[model samples]
Target: MVAKYVMLADTTRCINCKACEVACRAEWDTPLGYSRDWVKEVESVNAKGMPELQIFPGRCQHCDDAPCVEVCPTGASWKREDGIVLVDHDICSGCELCVPACPYDARWLNPVTNTISKCTFCQPRIDKGLQPACVETCVGNALIFGDANDPNSEVSILLKTKEWQRLITDEVNIGPNHYYYTAGKTIPVEVMPKLHERHLAGKSIESIVNPLGTIGIGGMMAVFLGAGVKKLVDRRKEVSEKEDNHEHH
Candidate 1:
């Protein structure tokens, strides 16, 4: 039995060229406005207090203790048989709730399809005995992928030999399967990109396309509210007219 797990990234080796992002887009035909994977450009303050830029390739961590799966009301999000966390598009209702539940911002609602999508660890390629698109396209060999459970596998060996750490936060312990080998104390936000505040500032259901079904719902709500208020005004007019008729009679 092959036990599936995650690969740790050695950030020191990454060149921030974004080959992984391109490969992912090409292979998946990701929409222009959204991506199943992303490369976050990070800038650190230099000694002169100027920003020094770096790039970090990020995707679904495929966490062992996944919070997205737990928070999802429909159970559309789940871990696959091989341990990769994935969303079942067939079951997803485009609620957009799971998007924020993910600490890594790994989940995204597809604007075209109106369903949630995220990284699947290239299960299709892995099943075919090929590396993930990102892993194969990495110019500097920065990304590595294999079974962490297998002691002889590349990922397992790397974890054992290298000083490594997992990205975590106290707020929500997602138990991210992705690991990192940075030569210093690990900060959760440092390993994961900081974009929640920005995302919150720009939050909207419009971020995900309004589906045909939802347009009716919105229209119905507006109509119902209008009719209810109009009915109340008409009732009040009727009562006043009845009192005047009774007095005249």
Candidate 2:
């Protein structure tokens, strides 16, 4: 059977050690300031007025209907058949259009690559029949990764036997694949999914390019379209110059 990959976070067992964060950074050689994964600590008061803490390990949800894929003009963002969302760095223009499209804010522009970057579910490691770096390094065994479509897969079994919830909001419904076990309690409002405002280019596309195509009236939309064209041209020139410089050296 074709495999559908998924990740599970058992918040009940998490220790908030940030091991996953460290492992991901090391695996990807992520820049000093950026990370592909993070563990968020949510603090609140319980019914007894006692301190309550919830730790959520987060990364790209690899949504079935990914908005990142939709907003990418260069088609650099794509979803693999196995449910991994990835950036094709070779084609990415570093436009940062996909960054704001994600409700989870899981993506970022890598300083080194100058391209959109996000969690890939450790595709390279999985291809070698190994677990993701984060999963392998998890101290408390709180993270689980496997094929969700296989009835015998650990993730599939867990979903069937345990209660879980995906981060979601009324404004956006992208069908995220990441599942969190919150122990039957409602997730905190701060950590719940929220749609971020679209980038200017994305807004232009939605309001002007898509709606009017080549017939956009004299307005900020036209200005945005012109600026977009200029940016694309500049990018091509930059790449060409870089290649020429490399040849000269």
Candidate 3:
């Protein structure tokens, strides 16, 4: 089996310090009012019957079946061979079709570049044999990244031994690669991904644009076929009438 990269998040050990967020910003120099990654702080009662802050470090799920790649008409949004979902700046059209398609709210249009931007798993750093910035700066060492397919990798062993859970809902389970280890604790309901109303433009492309194109092509083929059959039938009938006239004569 090929190596599939995955990020294992030990939510129980997360300190909610936002170190990962800072590290990501610094590494990418992300613009103002947008971020590539985030730490979700959900205030709720913990297992101890006391109000506790639940932290979930979130980013692009790098799903095995990603919706962003599906809605992108330009084919700019694509997943890498190792499971990292990324957007190509040159091919992106700033149409924002991918924005609403993402259930995790991971994609956004860059205000500066006018292109789609999202977490790349720090692909450049990974290519250079270094870890992602967020994983490197995690204060609690909660974030673990490696090839899950490798038997010798730490993530592979942890996944085998630990009871890990994915943030998947019944309605929209796209096979996200991120894993969460709650350490016998229940996750807060607030942080779960909710169903988003798709944007009008994106909706039309799927519902109107594609179906219309198919219908148009099919309709044209049907018209030409009907005309050809009619002409052939007329020609045969005309020849039959001439043969009858000759016999009568």
Leading candidate by lDDT = 2
Candidate 2 lDDT, 181-236, residue by residue in tens: 98998888877778766788789889887777556555668799899999999999
Q: Model 3 TM-score? A: 0.93
Residue 214 C-alpha lDDT in model 1: 86
Residue 59: error of model 1 in Å?
0.7
In candidate 2, which residue pairs clash? none
lDDT at position 178, candidate 1: 80
Q: Give the best candidate by TM-score.
A: 3
Clashes of each: 0, 0, 0
TM-score-sorted candidate list, best first: 3, 2, 1
Supply the global lDDT for candidate 3. Answer: 0.89
Residue 240 lDDT in model 2?
Answer: 100
lDDT of 3 by residue, 1-249 (tens): 767989999998999899998999999888977899999988877558999777899999998889889878889998888888888899999889788888899988888899988999999999887999999999899999999889999999999999998988888788989999988767666767667447797888779998999999999999999999999999999999999999999
Rank order by lDDT, top first? 2, 3, 1
Write candidate 1's Cα lDDT for 139-240 as tens digits: 877789998778899998888888877766655555677877666634436655333222332234334344545887899999999999999999999999
Instruction: State each model's CA lDDT, in order.
Output: 0.76, 0.91, 0.89
Better of 1 and 2 by lDDT: 2
How high a TM-score does candidate 1 get? 0.72
Which 10-residue span in candidate 1 carries the lowest summed lDDT? 193-202
